[model samples]
Target: WAIGLLEVAFSRYCPITFGIRTMGLMGLAYAHYSFWPIWSIPIMVYAFLPQLALASGISIFPKISEPGFLLYLFLFLGAYGQDCLDFLLEGGTFRKWWNDQRIWLIRGLSCHLFGTLEYLLKSLGISAFGFNVTSKVVDDEQSKIYSQEMLDFGVPSPMFVTLAVAAIVNFFSFSFGFLQMICGSDDNEGLPLQMLLAGFIMLNCWPVYEAMVLRTDKGKMPTKVTIIAAFLAWTLYAAAFHISFSK
Candidate 1:
């Protein structure tokens, strides 16, 4: 019961990030099952194996040989490998698709990371908000206009503000952690992995950073949202400092 409650709380906090990905993956699976049943087996295996490995920390196949692990890794790559192949078959150049992937990765990671911070704040009772609509339709003319005006990219929401704060915080956190490790600090035991993950998260959050500070797009962070997010960010930072140092 307690676990279920925790799950509900988590879901509420980062509502759409993983949900959107899961839905996309599910739709892909459904398409494969409907039109190309034979490929479904490999697709399912590729999708599930990495998750199993993560959940069990590879303990489920503890004695697996290196070759077995490599095979699993290849299968994991197959998920995206299939997409690349599809793009090629559809007359898309590899270079173009590869370039496009960078944009997609930025958008995806930014959304997920920002949503995560929003969720954390919500769980701590520091932030609260209602539903925000995500539109499916794109208006080419409006996009052109916004692009011409150098306006922000999407809706002006607290999410972007949170993302901006997170990007800055993670950037500094990673830098300090990396410096500590390089200087061979005594307390740098788990800092490497933490710093690496933080760096990766920030790398994928370039879009947010650009939207918030670099670009004048229609999707840029609004002043009011920025102020609110800055306050929340400071609150979180203080709480983390207290928790880490008080111990």
Candidate 2:
């Protein structure tokens, strides 16, 4: 979807027809396809990167004292408020909406991030995209496990690794930011939003945390996957620290 959106936006064309034709209508169509997918990139970046920076003792978020910061906050709240209203009008419960938000964050962190990377690689002619059809048929042993009400491990493990690392990064970042604010060792007026974002991501990460430390089923995260996630999170922190030091 990300690559397709980029292609369509760059070409300024829409291949899909909706039984309507007008210059303004066409413009709206183009904007819908083009702009919506672009949101995933920033959502993915903001979900993890600033937390990583905070973990590394470098704050890159805007200060609360900045005039534009309140505008950004208002915009964020307005968008989410609209979604909440829509959900309520559609007879959706708040818990379901909350879960929906969690899924959005998860997809942004995993598939959307991967999609953006693949799009970039494709643009640079360093990667080729192809489709692989997965078979739905299961063998006798697999069927037996399914009959026992066991969960399916349909998602790729690497995605779980990414989620695990994001959760870990958010956890420590929120903790560190809180400590810094409490100790008054750092100028932390800018950290409230960052900490709120970290807390929000961590709240949505309960399932990931469960898989990592609680679940004992086949769908539970493997020990090696946790180790890899930890290493990657540490690597991101180290890189951020080095970059801050160099600056």
Candidate 3:
């Protein structure tokens, strides 16, 4: 995640630095937190191959959503015509049709409630009028099922997890803080480039822990304990960063 932020800061000079690339890195971190072998295996693979493999599997599910919705939606939205003739019908007014569309999309997605829930949970005040399915009969008894994620990403690497906590805190701190600096001119200081630089650097720079420590620290520390340590890292990192860089 840190690497991504740095890349963005270096290349994609947005008003808020490291916006897009940090997204990739954050996904990597989340995988490290929520899925142990998932992220680790990819890293191991990348370590070995170092050529073709990218440790981006953690980002697969995440990047394939609403924002990424644009990519495939063009292909599917075209099918909306078929959706109208074959899928959507009478709701009442155009607004009614739109609301109906939402309900139908939700219900048709019953087969994959988990994926559907992914969209629903993130969307707030999102109720709308579109395609609504009045009566739908579909048997879920024979639905094909795959495995579920083991658990939260933290279960595996639970030891001395100051780094993980620091990552999360740094993510929100820099991400939101940058947003604030951009959106609200209350105290805007031209992007705080130095603070952003610190955040990106601190994200990747950490003490070298022996392999034994990393392997042994399986859910050893409490979540709360690590959370505190994480924020401290960010605070110290950002403060030291701006202090050194300030003119």
Candidate 4:
């Protein structure tokens, strides 16, 4: 997120500092914006916002009958289809393409979220940030242990927890929207796209679900992480509900 912001910022401020330059430099600045920060930050922040609003009886997302909703859906499908086509054109297998998609979701929920938060907190002078150098060398004993264990323990706990909570929240949101549609609610019309979005997130979260519920390997999500994620998701829903009623 910072990289993207910095690119645009430089584009704007560099001209004022060093007089006007070619339009090519301006284009270069904007074109250099990192895809991860440009898209993933917004995805991380807004993934559940509209659903939370709807849970609170607030209509923020577009209804299925609305042109905006169709546009949004088409935009998603078009980008996704294009990506798939690119992968196939490059001779990637279906399974590899699917794994790449899931990895994108995982990185968005975990690394992108952390990166954005770190950037903001540092900018606000609330936190200190610096790069730390680590050894690249690996010993045979340690390498063997890591290979044998296949543990996800190397990842920071917060990242795992964030990923788990995102999966759980999306799962619950999709289920809630599904149930509402099945019950024939008047408000179901506005929920289709939201539900579809949630369901898409949930589908990409299959690995997390497997780790949380099915896997017995060392790579599985810990019991504490599952408990924490479930609690956080419930708390978010409860808070949204309370706010809606209070309003």
Question: Which has the greatest TM-score?
Answer: 2
Using lDDT as the measure, which candidate wins? 2
**Model 3 misplaced regions, further than 4 Å:** 1-147, 151-163, 181-221, 241-246
In candidate 1, stretches whose alpha carbon ends up further than 4 angstroms from where it belongs are 1-142, 145-154
Worst 10 residues of 1 by lDDT: 50-59
Per-residue lDDT of candidate 3, residues 60-98 (tens digit): 211223454354445445654556654345434544454
Give the TM-score ranking, best first: 2, 4, 1, 3
Report the lDDT of model 4 for residue 90: 100
Clashing residue pairs in candidate 4 (N, C-alpha, C atoms within 3 angstroms): none
List TM-scores for all candidates, in order: 0.47, 0.77, 0.23, 0.76
Clash totals in order: 10, 0, 17, 0
- Give the alpha-carbon lDDT of every model: 0.51, 0.74, 0.36, 0.70
Q: How large is the C-alpha RMSD of every model relative to the true structure? A: 11.7, 4.2, 22.0, 4.5
Tens digits of per-residue lDDT for model 1, 1-247: 2222234434532223443466755544443322222332332232233222222222233122435645544664675689889989999988667656545443333444344445556668886444456776657855774566433545765435545665666666666666666788665543433454456557656665666667664566666766766676566566656655566
The whole-model C-alpha lDDT of candidate 3 against the native structure comes to: 0.36
